[model samples]
Structures are given as C-alpha cells and as structure tokens.
Target chain A: MATLKVLVTGEDHAQGPEDADVTLVEYGDYECPHCGRAYPIVKQVQKHFGKRLRFVFRNFPLSEMHPHAEAAAEVAEFAGAQGKFWEMHDRLFENQERLGEALFLDLDKELKLSATAMRQALAQKTFEARVRADFTGGVRSGVNGTPTFFINGQRHNGSFDFDALVSAIQQVMITAKSA
Target chain B: MAQSGASKVTPIHSDRILPAGAGAPNFTLHATPDQTLTLSDLLGRPVILAFYPADWSPVCGDQMALYNEILPEFQKFGAELLGVSVDGAWCHAAFAESRHLHFPLLADFEPKGAVAQQYGAYRDADGFCDRALFVIDKKGIIAWSYCSPVAVNPGADGILEALEDLPK
Candidate 1:
C-alpha cells in the first residue's frame, strides 16, 4: 500500500473549488517530455469534469537529468507570488521545448509581470526554497517520477493517458455518488 | 488507497521486509565482468542494497533511473547505493551503461537469487527479487527496509529518511 504520505493542504497551489467532488493533484517536472505530453490530456480532463474537479500542481524536478527544470520551477513559483501561477504554468507546458532564461523573460513580458522584479527574484534565488518545498512534498507523497497524479489524496497508480485518467476520475465520481 | 489503472494487476506490499537491527547478510558478487565486490568491503559507510527483479523491466528501470538521478543526495549522507538483480554481469553492465547509472549493480546470478534469498527479498513464486530495499548502517546493521510492489517504483525518500535518522 504505497499511499500519499502528505495530503493536499491549503498551502499548496491549487485550482477549482475547495469543495469540488474530486481532487486531482499532479507531481510534475517542468522539463519532462512525458509531462509535456500529458499537459493537454490534463486540460481535457479538467474541461470534461468542470466543477466536479479540483486541480493541484506540485514541482518534482529531476534537475540532474533536466538541467532547466529547477530554474523553470523557480520561475513558476515566482509567478505564483504575483498571483500568476497558472499563467506561468500553462506557458511552461505550452512551450516545453523552449525552456530557458530567454523563455522566462519572454513570459514575464507577456504576462505583464515586472521585468525588473522578475530579474531580481531570479538573481537572488527567490522562490527556490518554495519550489524545493513542493519537490520535498512530492517525494514524501511517493512520487517516483514526473507527472504522478493523485485522486482524492490517494496515489493514482495508473497510466496518466487521457482515457485512463478519465476512467479513474469517473470511478471516483461513481464511488462518491454511491457513498 | 485506490488501486486503479496501472495498479490493478500489481500485488500489494506486505511485511515481508527484513527487520531493522538485524545483521545484514554478506556476499561477494560480480560487479563487472572481471571485477567482484564483497559486502564486507563496504562496512564502514552506510550501504543501500536495492534488490530489484531484473533489468529492463519498466518499473525496475524507472526505479533505478530515479535512484541514479538522486545519487548525489544519497552521497550527501555518506551513503553508497548498490543495485542487486539476478541478472548476469554482462546484462548488468549493459543495463548500467544504457541507463547511465552511477552505482554498481551486483549480479546475484551464479547461485540465482542466493543473496536476495539471504536478505529475505527473493520471490520464489516470481523467480526474482520482489523489489526490496535495505539501508544498512556503518556497522552492517540493517537500519530500515521496504518491499515495494513489483509494478511500482518505491522512490528514494525512505532510504534518505533512514540515512538521516542514523545515530550520529
């Protein structure tokens, strides 16, 4: 029984309603190709479920393998501080192949973020600890790799493809309805 | 938790682990085709013996790759990682190179699960080790152990936590 050691809390970055019927948490790496492939699928699942779903994203960067991952995570956390987490998060996945300093700066401009503040934040390593905390939380939650999902505080031990994810979420919905 | 999707066919993890404070069983196994590594030689530093089923299996590969990526973290606690499998030295060598693994993978092949059996990790029903992990202290005392489901990659957090808990 490999379960999530850490349950989702308010301190976490989350979307949808807190009282949603189903919760979907993803431990993802910004630079992972598999996670990039999963981006659209997760979006589709969100659209399908609508108000029935709550979404949370946590960082679990494999920095050694993905050199750009740590920086990208920090950038997302920075945007999160400015109330623009989802904006940066969506752009990161949308432009997974173009991950770098240049991309972060470009995103800062497009998102109407203060370029000077963003530069100082990166220079001072701000949000590094926050991103690292998210990573540590993921590790404690039994996240072995990127794009690991949890449904209702339990590890979703399945292929994260669109169909599999949909079926798993629907199962939760059915159980909730029956209960 | 919910055992849906990839976990439908996966077996549950049970209390099949070797308990902590027990003396770690020793062995000599081929690390490279021409090189042999003995357990006793690594008694001074904490050792992590990860006995997995075989090379190239999806779960095992993911587990090893994750360990490989986190090798430095294990090293920070002055710990050494060794992957043990029932595969031959040549197979281990190829797998190590293909995955760019930084740790030595000992072959438990000659006697086929001999070392794994001694560690109570061998799964006779499946003819392989049941994806077990053992963290041994400097004095060769087992500090902690876990038996993960064959289909899952039981990441390195437990091992790291065990290392951090080692009496200083």
Candidate 2:
C-alpha cells in the first residue's frame, strides 16, 4: 500500500470510515471560533458533494480550552430526541455560551421544542453513549485538535480553502478510477 | 405574552464575548490571590490566551516557555498573557512556581472545562485538551483564534506578528 504523508493512524493522524470516493469527518469543538468559521465550510462541502460524500463528525472538544463544548454535546444529544440534533448542533456552534440547564430550556422554547421532554432526556443523559462513541472514534483516529478533518480517507491539517478541498477530492477520485 | 417570550430568549454567551474583528471581550477569570481579573483590568492592552492540554507535556512546556522569551516583545505590543488548563488552581500554582512562569496558568478544573469551553480546546476521550490559542485586542473581542495539533508548537514570532500588524 502506498503510504500517505498527510496522516498517521496513532500519531497525528485521525481515523475514520474507509473506502469512500469522498469521506468528510470533522473534529470540532462547539465553542471554538475557528470551528465556528469551519462550520459553514463543512456544510458547503456536504451540500455540494451530496450523497457522493460520506460525512462523519467526531468530538475533539478542547474542554480545557472550550469548557462548554462537552456539556453542549450532551445537550445536543439530549435534543436529538425530537430529531433536533442538527438544530441544536448549529445552535451550539452559533451561540456557545448558553450551554447550561437554563439556556437549554430557553433554546428549546426558541426552537418550539418540548422543554419538558428535552429536560427529561438531558437529565437521563440519553446521548451519553453516542457522545462517548464519537469521542472514542476521535481518539482512536488521532484527532489531536479541533477543526480537523478526514476527506476521502486523507487527513487534512490546518484550515482549508474551498478550492483545496475540491482538488484533494479530485485526486482521490482519479486514483480510485486508475486502480 | 410576546414580551415574556422575548425575555425568555437566552443570552448566547453572557459571561463570554464574541470573536469579532479589532475588539476583545471583557473576561473576569479566577486568578492568583483567588480573586477576579477582568480584560478591562488590562485596558490599552492586547491579551493572549495560550491554552494547552497538560502542563507536563513536552510540546506544551516548550510552548509555555516561548511566551517568556517573547515577554518583552509582548509588553512592547501592550499585551497581557496567561496560560490555561483544566488543572486545579493548586496545580496551576505549583506548575507556575516550579516552571518559574512569569504569567499565571489559569485553572479551568471546575466543571472540568470552563475556560476551554470559552476557547474550544477540549478533548473528551483522553480527558485532556489540545493546544489552542486565542488573541484578543484591548477592547475585549476575540481578534484571532487558532487551534493547533496536539504535538505542534505554535511559533511565538508568528503570533507576535499577528499582533504587530494590527492597526494601533
């Protein structure tokens, strides 16, 4: 197998699902401004690539740096009950500070969700296992920081420009075709 | 009822400030002397919040020392700096005392990640943090924020340059 310079499995490399023409997995913290910057970019890639791409998200919440991210992840998972995962996900990234019990209720009201049900879900920590799985996946894959990504099985370090992502995907596609 | 509903809207980050251009947010962190220190306390200054995973890590040690090396330069640019981690306040005290760190190493241990949440540098699996840096101007809005790979060292000069290029 031709080794890849961009990634290492246990070192600086981040692991994710294998064998997609394009796989986009992001390691993000809900409270990170840069992660906030990268949010729309990931959405752009997902929207542009559609089903041709497999998108995965892993947690690399720098809780030492972004303390509220872990709590917010739990909150989002709790909100997943009403199928509000994406909504809570965006809300967290957009406004990271309102991540306590009170804010969750307020946000539920704003989103017209069942505050009572959401509170129950959160108290029970229904999404603990799922959040744990995502974090475990991130650690196994070597995601060392926030806002990291794996596109088509290739690890991308640093912030990305739109054109760079397209080119990387194009290269992967070409190699697959030749193989 | 509508007014009550409007009042019900949650303030996004009341204790925290948004990352905006050319301005910084007022932050009152629990510092040494076990009291509060605000961004406004350091008025007419830039602030650098250098976040790291663990105090004992090789790269983090080097990274922390870099701040001292550029202490004069940072002072010249009118910036106050601090290092933060999820370590307890006592741990921060010891780490700073042993390393002879000129700046305070903040304690973000309570709730396991208060400060990290402010900067977005928490990692759940390892229960440690990845190195992240946040630059704030005198006014207390986040000017620039960068999150680096775990083992990497963010160049001191590069960050200083980012500050220098700013409109004075």
Point to the candidate with the largest DockQ. Answer: 1
DockQ of model 1 vs. true complex: 0.40
lDDT of 2 by residue, B1-168 (tens): 000112333332222333446344345666664765666777667788877888866557656754653465577787888887777777777777765678877766767765576555666655766566777776666777666555555545345656876669
* Strongest candidate by lDDT: 1
User: Which sections of candidate 1 miss by over 4 Å?
Assistant: A114-116, A174-179, B1-21, B32-35, B72-77, B88-100, B123-128, B160-168
Total clashes for model 2: 22
CA error at residue A158 for candidate 2, angstroms:
4.2
What candidate 1 keeps of the native contacts, as a fraction, is 0.43
What is candidate 2's lDDT per residue for A1-179, written digit by digit as tens?
11122332322212233444666767677876667877777678766666666666555555444556767777776666566667877777777656666777787888788877776766787766766656545444534345656665555643455666666676777887799
What is the C-alpha lDDT profile of model 1 across B1-168, one tens digit per residue?
112355354564457667898999989999999999999999899999999999987678778878887787789889999999999999999999988888999999989999998888988888898789999999999999988777777887788889999986
> Tens digits of per-residue lDDT for model 1 on A1-179?
44566777887788889999999999899898989988899999999999999999988888767889988998998999989999999999999999998999999999999878887888899988887777766776677877888898777887888888999899998998899
